[model samples]
Target chain A: MKFAVVVFPGSNCDVDMYHAISDELGEEVEYVWHDVDSLDDFDAILLPGGFSYGDYLRSGAIARFSNVMKAIKKAADEGKPILGVCNGFQILLEAGLLPGAMRRNNTLTFICRPVKLRVENNETMFTSQYERGEVITIPIAHGEGNYYCDEQTLQQLTANNQIVFRYEGENPNGSLQNIAGIVNEKGNVLGMMPHPERAVHELLGGADGLKLFQSIVTYWRDAHVVTT
Target chain B: MYKVKVYVTLRENVLDPQGNAVKGALHSLNYREVQDVRIGKFMELLVEKSDRDIDAVVKEMCEKLLANTVIEDYRYEIEEVVVQ
Candidate 1:
């Protein structure tokens, strides 16, 4: 499967995401600049993390207006799997691709460390490789990672099984219900603050995040493979 | 010319850790009567006069960029300015 790693100015993790997909996962990947108006060539989209637009007005607020977002929206409507990590998650929230918004960490500090996440749901394309109720370690780095939404929206998320990952032991940034990641209602889009690409190597930390990438590839191949 | 002042704040139910920290500092400084505190964003915009309704323009800006309606509430005041 071909992947497009969206690159915005100040996106520090774009290379990491590319390396993870191309080297570790052995998938075709390329860096797609934020100014590009078309995303027709890519089968999957990855929005990497960084202080886009300097995180000026708000995290992900300014980056949401980038030209590429329109194409990303179009890709999402076509049911292409899209993953947003860290600042990318913030952008998805600001762009209304995913519900809710991020607030300052309850500690009012930029937290950067490894965190344990529980697989809340294993049916989605992103987490299908993870065992149900399995715990995995991934690194999180951000200040505005506290996720917030109304009570009603939270209920809908729970009912739809959209809550994909939850903080296993301790909530690092005080996210609501220890929510570490979530998917859209259609299950094609996922936004999470943790850096899964960073965890794809055992020497770097752990290879727990590789399965997520593998799951996406496996799902795409299964659904798209044609019989002659 | 017109001067527009905008205030953007978190919704009532949302938690503000920075505000809480500031409140704690005030308490430590012996300001006992402080009941609550909320931190928000304040922006000043100078807009040129035009035929379009100023209120509508400011409202649209607030909704589109200045404030995120999902978690924030915004209010703005517009004042006509007389240049020398």
Candidate 2:
């Protein structure tokens, strides 16, 4: 029921993530600086999007070396649910928490708009609230969201149902197999380029992304809270 | 001193949009016979003499920070320099 939004220098989406968890989802949330070494107090870890380390060298490359990443790895090993959106997704890839890497959008442009995403698998802790094959509108904003992995890795992902979200219509960034998001083999860590926190309110455009946050809370309650 | 020149390029299986764009530009300029084009990054590092093996050091640096082995391939040339 508690969330820690990891804040790196140049992290622009930390506030948005905090707002989503606190105001929209009504959950306990706080900002954890990248320098912090431990995340023992938080139940879920959220890595927000931004031009971390100014996206120098490569997106998420420099930020991966931050002190907090070691603790994040520890959290992953403990099976804590971690969500990385946008550049946060890039960081997770660089940190090796998730597979694959991002590349320049095939069109070579920064894309920003709401795109339809099909829920590829609904069994993961993050997407349990979404119905299988359900189409939801989530906004994506990035220039290097083109996800790539070796063929063998792709086969494993497909076999394990790790590919969580796929572009429903046109592949905006030319991601392989229209992959918009994926989860680790354990299914606890999710890295997606689309901004779910940004779409928690209907007024903003759509409320389709709210279920993802709700799903995390549901998973935590099921594991931690005992029924009378 | 050692001057290390590192070159990092996308793996053969990966696509390079920037390189493709540049190739398109060349074609528009009427430069036929240009078979293919690929883009990559170049970096220079000045390393002071150390007890560690230079080749091993450079390789470790490239694998750890300078390049991502998943999607990128890196090569380096070391030039020993005498500092005054």
- CA lDDT of each candidate? 0.95, 0.95
Chain A: TM-score in each candidate? 0.99, 0.99
- lDDT for each residue of candidate 2 in A7-65, tens digit (9 for 90 to 100): 99999999999999999999999999999989989999999999999999999999999
Model 1, residue A224: distance off in Å is: 1.5
For model 1, how does the per-residue alpha-carbon lDDT over A44-148 read when each residue is reduced to its tens digit?
A: 999999999999999999999999999999999999999999999999999999999999999999999999999999999998899999999999999999999
Query: Lowest-lDDT window of 10 residues in candidate 1 chain B?
Result: B10-19
How big is the positional error of residue A134 in model 2, measured in Å on the Cα after superposition? 0.4
Query: lDDT tens digits, residues B19-76, model 1?
Result: 8999999999999799888999999999999899999999999999999988899999
Please tell me how candidate 2 rates in CAPRI terms: high
Question: Which parts of model 2 are misplaced by more than 4 Å?
Answer: none
> Total clashing residue pairs per candidate?
0, 0
Q: How does residue B11 of candidate 1 score in lDDT?
A: 85
For model 2 the local lDDT of residue A15 reads 97
